[model samples]
Target: MAMRGVSHVEVFVRDKVSAVRHLRSSLGFAHVADCVEVDRSSALLRRGEVQVVATSGWATRAFIARNGEGVAGFAVTCDDVPAAEGAARALGAEVSALPRGRVTVTGIGDVAHTLLPADGHDPGAPPAGRRWVPRDGAWPAAGGAWALERVELRLPVALRERYPAFLSRVFGLERHPAQRSWLYSAPAGVTFALEEQRAPVPLEPPARAAAGSPPAASVTAYGLAFRALPAPVLR
Candidate 1:
């Protein structure tokens, strides 16, 4: 498979506006586009080379109702989408054809990969609908103040070996030696690690009652790692 690496990640949330605001304020992401349909709303945000689509609507509500707000899937850029989809299917991966010639391959847990052409179409671009005013300008270059460095997946200890093998066979990622986890480096410089977990683990402890907030969702199948770059000095 001619995998170029992850193009963008899709996160399902209850409120697209709030989610986008949080990402912009907390992660330094810039709102790029918005798509609003009768049933749902989605916003595109970017920082460095990382793009995230936060969506909410009927389908999103149902997803969050079941799984809570978290990453739903990610798209990978491919030189040949059809060929990559074929390769993934040959590896016994559950594959589904999405609209606009995109392909989705189910991965561990609920996470899936949407295979997209590598012709520079922003996978995070606003889908067809009522379009919000798009911010004009090129996306910030990679290696900015904060950049996604790695993505760590926590799965059952039983899948520690099989999952990595699956990724290697399907995506052609190269496995590397790691102390306590399985690390695979993608061609586009993203490191993916599978960490073993005997039982379900929450991302953080329950929110205090007086805080009047719900506890954070249990750790999902994956978590992102970002690095803080040094501020550029001006002479």
Candidate 2:
């Protein structure tokens, strides 16, 4: 089976409603779909080809409770979810079942994950009302608007080999030539680069000014960067 590269980035937040509003109003993202259950809420948002799955729940919130609100996991689209799950299991990923149509897996360092098959999975399409918005307009020569350029994974120093093997087994990601990392791609022009982190991890909320304060989005020791499209594609 030909598994696609990274299709979406999934974030675990405290409140899905507030996150949806904030992403739309402040971050220029538009909601594409909402999947809510008895205790969890997930909203899919898009800006250009970039998509995000923002979630909140007891299980999801555990990432926040332990690491604070930040990107908890990433998802790579696959030809078959069960096939991917089997591959992940072969690579030693901790696995679990999800309702409707999804599965969760964790590799070394317990990197959290969710597996969704390519068919019938509509986190919906890009929002209709808005155009794309670029942060700096420093679009790469690569013609595609909004491609995943890089992603950082804060893996435990010990579980180095297992993480890369897990990504390779599940997504067929090859090693990037320049960086000592894994790369996956799709026909739709999505690129995912995963780098193991080696910095001090911050568990508490980063320091803030005062009440009504918002901490800097750049505080986390680990992060992922997605390349943006040209101005025209955004529109």
Candidate 3:
């Protein structure tokens, strides 16, 4: 099985509209698509190779109620979904099959991992049950100016020794030779690090502010690092 790096991060928010607005206005992301179902609404945004799916509604309310607004899970592209799912199961990960042959597995805290087939399809497309409707008007050109550098995950110190090995075996990531930090990297240029915490920290939901106030900090479990690329030199 080949791990093709993170395809997208799914964040469960109380307000999808607010989340989408903040990302587009503050982070230079472009809203690409929207997915609406009976129980949920999702907005897909992209900036360079990074994709974010902000979702709200009944399906996400339970997660937000417990952990507050934060990342519910993330999807990674895999060459063989069955092989990857089997490997993760054998390594003690709780695995479940989803619609359209997708597989989801347990990860640290409330974070789950969804395995998506890397079949040369557009990675930013909405998942099953969500129809993709392109947004109107021109979107800001990414021009490969943004690259996801790292994903930081915080876990209880008790699992420090075993969790890194589990991630390596399941995702085929290389373990960085650091005794203090459990860092793993993939060939696709993204790093996943397990930071030790005394206990799981619940992310506080973004506070409701008066209209026209600055956006509040996004509630997220994954600490993301992004690099801005230099403008291309013109001859």
Candidate 4:
């Protein structure tokens, strides 16, 4: 595959209407409805260099019903979409064609991913800090002072152990072994980490989580791994 790296991640939302607001204010993302999208008009939330697409209304409801609304899909930038699709087939993956310059490649859990053109980070150079306004004339307020850094893929204990190898095989990511989480460096600079789908084993107590949780997005919301901004001192 001529994979450059991750282009953008499509996070299905159980609550699309609210998710957009939370992403904007609570996470420092601006909801920019600028770029052209594939299949649907996605809610484009961007910050710094990170971009996330989420479908709205009925499409949002349907996908959430079937997949439980987390990061159901992500896109990888490649030299060519068709060639990457072929590469996915060579690796025994299920590939499907999508409209626009997108191609779906399967065999990674219930996640549906696609291959996109290897364009630079921001093709249009859309300015940052511009608030995304809705058709209804209402605008979401921005409050948080953090940017999206990385994303953590919460998987079942059984799947967590195997997913790193799967991504390595498919995306050609270099696996960087960590103490608890397994990190895979995408050629595009961002990383995809796999963590046990139990309670956050690193911080939260075991009691906070049930005995056996299903590998569903309902349990883990796909939010940014933020690096806290400097806090202002109160007088």
Candidate 5:
């Protein structure tokens, strides 16, 4: 079966205010949600049909620091995990045991995914790739050459095989020798890629509301060229 289009791009941010401001002012993102949990703090913003999630989590800090500031993770909706998992394994992915409770599916690419039970997620909850659009506006633009595309992560270069293997296990992806990278497709013909960056950048400290709070800095963001961006402020 086909996988659903990207629901959203999740980012680890340093400053909630600055991240939100940058997306809203510099990139035209609109604030969607803001609040703090018992320990973590987070803010949601959107531009066009893409959702940008910024979270300040105690655990997420290390990931941001080690990986550098940039796109951290991606989410995809698939029809069947078992089948996809099989395909990924055939391609040399390193599959890990499923996690309890969360319906997790982990593999190499440093990618991890969870299945949304048949009942579905909450009403106003933000889906993975869909967060870029606002609650009110022109809505999302339609049709693109490739429904999804992403810039590759710049690993230590030493971790090339290791990273790709991880992706294979986690998302059930397959490496395309032709492209010299891994790829996976959803039932809808929407495809995602794991590319390689020329250089990797260092991670920055996250911004915070005050002392002893979660960091607010986002790792990094990739530019998506919509087949057509709306004229009247597309977010």
Candidate 6:
């Protein structure tokens, strides 16, 4: 019925060391898996309940030369692909078929979303949101920085205002609790915030983006997982 919150976000980086360090030491992300190819490498990382898929290769080099380290794309999970696909299509989103029960839902500015069908939910699972419960070595004092809170995407001035409504209509997102903000809440409590930057920032697609691909922006920053971030020394 509702779109599962963000499944994962892709980040493109030039230096895997610095990026991995920032995400791990600074942001409390833990490495899950990695892949190394002839000229590029990537790894999957996690913090709290969110997942970050980072890729580095030739496209990453071009991306860094152009716009620096940023998010390449994001994915979401839903119960019904046909309904979600239909919603995306009705809004002029370019829906592309993918192998293995996947679909790419492209929004304005060519925002790429790989949609996948969700697994059956457990009936007795705890309500999913920020977990304030204490975990050893998980606090800033214990060498933790922060967990990802939300995602921010800066769009063109022309499209900034309309996109949220578009998201609301298609993704079934509601306004973030902050009231009067650009943030929208996806199911499972994940959120996406939008803004119109002073200058139109280029959409920095992942280094693997196809040539002449639609112009797309990058994910600039992930919000703190908690509402109020703990005071810590940001290196």
Count of clashing pairs, candidate 4: 0
Q: Relative to the true structure, how large is the alpha-carbon lDDT of every model?
A: 0.64, 0.59, 0.70, 0.57, 0.49, 0.59
lDDT of 2 at 114: 64
Question: Global CA lDDT of candidate 4, please?
Answer: 0.57
Please provide, for model 4 over 112-207, each residue's C-alpha lDDT reduced to its tens digit, 9 standing for 90 to 100: 676766654333232222343453354333344433345566566667656666666556666665634655554565566665454322212112
- Candidate 3 residue runs with Cα over 4 Å from true position: 97-101, 137-143, 154-162, 177-179, 195-222, 230-235
Can you give the lDDT of residue 165 in candidate 3? 69
Best by lDDT: 3
How far residue 33's Cα lies from its native spot in candidate 5, in Å, is 1.4
Off by over 4 Å in 4: 34-42, 56-69, 80-84, 99-101, 119-122, 125-148, 156-158, 179-181, 196-221, 226-235
Q: Write the per-residue lDDT of candidate 5 for residues 1-235, one digit (tens) a residue.
A: 2344455555665555666676665445667755566655666665545555666667456656655444565555455556555655666655443432123444444444444322243323465322334444443442222223443454555666766665555445565555675455433233344445444364343333456765323223432322223245558
RMSD of 1: 6.8
Q: 20-95 in candidate 2: lDDT tens per residue?
A: 7766664556575666567766777666566777778987755655445556777655677888788878876788
| lDDT of candidate model 3 versus the reference | 0.70
Clashes of each: 0, 4, 0, 0, 48, 5
RMSD of each: 6.8, 9.0, 5.5, 9.4, 9.6, 11.9
Clash pairs, candidate 2, are: 132-234, 145-229, 146-228, 146-229
lDDT of 3 by residue, 135-231 (tens): 8844434346676666766555667777776677767777776634645555557777666553335544434557888643332223565666567
Where does model 1 exceed 4 Å of error? 37-39, 61-68, 98-101, 119-146, 154-162, 195-222, 228-235
Candidates 1 and 5, the one with greater lDDT: 1
Per-residue lDDT of model 6, residues 28-72, tens digit only? 567655666667777666654556766788856754453345656
Candidate 5 wrongly placed segments (more than 4 Å): 85-102, 107-111, 115-125, 128-148, 154-159, 165-179, 182-235
lDDT of model 4 at residue 202? Answer: 20
